[model samples]
Target: MNAPSPFSDMLFEKREEQAILTDLAYANGWMLDVDGCLVKTTKAGGAGGHAIGGAAKLLDWLRRNERKFVICTNASQRTVATYASHLRSIGLDIADHEMMTAATAAGETIARAHPGGRILVVGDEGMLEAIRSAGLEVTPPDASNADAVVVGAADTYSSANLNAACLSIADHGAPLYTSVSSPWFHGGVKRSIAVSSAIAQAIASVTGVQPIVCGKPSRELGESLRLRLSGGNSQIVIVGDAAPAEMRLARGMGAMGVLVLSGATQADELSGLPVDQQPHWVVQDIDELADQLQRVIP
Candidate 1:
């Protein structure tokens, strides 16, 4: 037999679900912040690709109603244009500007910290391009004069890259930056430690300088979104699967958090979390949440 859900008092009950969702719809607007909450990849860690489900329908409905929403994600493996193309391939029809990514956020953060300055990036081609797109000069990791070090997703990391980053921070006194701080993420079938996190950890160990994260759960991303969605009186709603990252992001932004079981987090994990860390709503998936929204938002 399964144990009772601690959220039983707040969720699934008909009246309470209606009441909460109603208030959510009435808010200034909603932000469907994480990709994992809406789409699932075919392979572990999105190595394969993505597929859309009920979340696509939800997006269409929101668009038809002229509602304000953004599909924000922390996956910084590619540029926003590439991610948008990937979504289009899956028939989701998302525009590049409609999405916010950790890559873009990292770029924006770096630009603000050291505008037009050279940055040593330790990541993949996508991360390098993102930094460049942010209007900052990209220096090779070995560049001794790099003003900062920005770390992101990188499948190929070497000792040489690590050494360059260390030298940049310790010797050059360059600040260290990262896309996301979470050590691990839910790839479709299993959890994997983020390449950026691993590299950041190694650099911090050597230089004794912690990285400033610019992705989810960091105020940087939230502040970026706040600027993007200015002149809004609606409340913000963050829906995602990861607890440590997405839930913390919602808390940091003072937005409503909805957890779906289709991604990283499982129902059993909720019991172990602190009361404050718990999501305000829990559902089986985006489809179920959409159903709830349809019933209450009209």
Candidate 2:
């Protein structure tokens, strides 16, 4: 398959004190972004998504080759099990263990920051699932007191829920945790603002407290990815479309970053970037790598 842009189609790797892609098969593990990389999902959490850019063929290859990989998404609207099911329905069969969400990081963060403590949640079932899985208790939406307030994506942003979250933080003098602080996440044509960040900001403004970010570029999810995919310093390659966040994360984790234009990024956005924000390798989309991997990984 031909790449969308010649400038990004190279399969080589070298860095001037910066970066490069690990020869596909050499890396012990891979971290793939979900929404924009493998599939195009609507911003509405859990909305329908379709596999794109040779996604089916590439994922099938990974499974057949027994590649160590994880599908990471910042979407926190559903549980891991639900996400796995959703992805499978879209022709991308992802297992629960191979999936990581911002909610998952939130769970880990809350567990470590406030273990066994009750907290108010402003997200969806997924957020609650992650928190509970980490052995933390969830307080009801109407409850006024809690150890902390956690926010993430939600289908509905009700007044009652907002008030409860505020009270939980104000009454208990609890801290606030948000899955992501990014105002916008890529999705379908009608781009939607990140409800989680909006909620977090509202809570912050009302309570006069700062939020502890728990999404990409945050060490919590990075540590989780390392523990799940990396085996004691084994190489990791991350392929995603988002800028700064995805690339920055890869840099911080000492992993190779590969950007696919098939998702949120465009050619114009890649101009004159700093070394720290540059992707090790740039391809038109997943199919470019798919074409490369077809020749190499097998």
Candidate 3:
């Protein structure tokens, strides 16, 4: 398929980079993003969300091929097992160890920063579990004292919780960590704000401390990916729609960053941006991308 713009044209022309990715997937492995890139937000024309599409087939093929593969997501509300269960429930068919999420990455990063740290976490049971796996304890603000504040998607966020988190961070000189800070994404007709970014902004405004984000473009997720792949950064490929986060991550870890036009970033969004802001290959979606890869890899 032809690229939508000249910026995309330049991105595709870098055959040297493309060769490396094709070689990597053909030889070692590939990493994929779940939302938008693989799963559609809504059922189309009577098909449910669980409908097994081309992307799911690709995932199956990866498993069959026995090449290293992992699902790297910025969604912090779920544990790795929960993410895998959702995939299986939705008919995607993936293993628990095959998933790596920002929630897990953030917990790991915070654990390293403050050893045996007390964490004031805002999220579901999954977030709590991920933190605990990394050797950290979690608590609600008023019930207990904590050494740091960890924010993500939560059903219990409010003015009181925000104020309490800020106070904890301020009093203990604890570092603040957030799983993600993305603004919004399209869903049906309306747009929804990412919970992590909203909570991070609120706490920063009140406490005057910028929370350290450990997902998406951050190295924490990269580290998790590194472990799951076990093939090092040179053989991994990061695919996504957002340039700012995924692209920065690819560059930082010497991985191939492939972007598709199936989600948040429209084709025209790449105009006048530097080369670093573009993907290694711009395609329509995972289906077309898989077809393209067949030609390049073989």
Clash number for model 1?
A: 5
In model 3, which residue pairs have backbone atoms overlapping below 3 Å? Answer: none
Output the number of the lDDT-best candidate: 2
Candidates' lDDT values, in order? Answer: 0.77, 0.79, 0.71
- For model 1 the TM-score comes to 0.88
Question: The CA-based lDDT of model 1 is what?
Answer: 0.77
| Model 3: per-residue Cα lDDT at residue 166 | 77
Task: Please give, for residues 1-298, the per-residue lDDT of candidate 2 as tens digits.
Answer: 9657644444331232222233655677888887677877775333587777687777788888777998888889888888888888877777888888899989988898898999888889989999999999998887778898899888798898888878777777888999998888785233578888888998999989889988886777778788888555878888888776678788888888888887667778888666766887888888887877776656
By descending lDDT, how would the candidates be arranged?
A: 2, 1, 3
Estimate the Cα RMSD of every predicted model relative to the unseen true structure. 4.6, 5.6, 5.5
Candidate 1 lDDT over 61-125, as tens digits, reads 68766677777777777777777777777767678788777878899888988999999888877
TM-score of each: 0.88, 0.87, 0.84
Residue pairs with colliding backbones in model 2 are none
lDDT of 3 by residue, 1-298 (tens): 9659987778877766677656645746567776667765542111133422567766765776677877777777767887777777777777887777778888888888888988988666667888999998777655334788888776566666676687787776767889887777432222467777888988888779998888888877777677767747447778776677677777777787777677666688877446666676677777777766655643
Flag the better candidate by TM-score, 2 or 3.
2
Cα error, candidate 2, residue 114 (Å) = 1.7
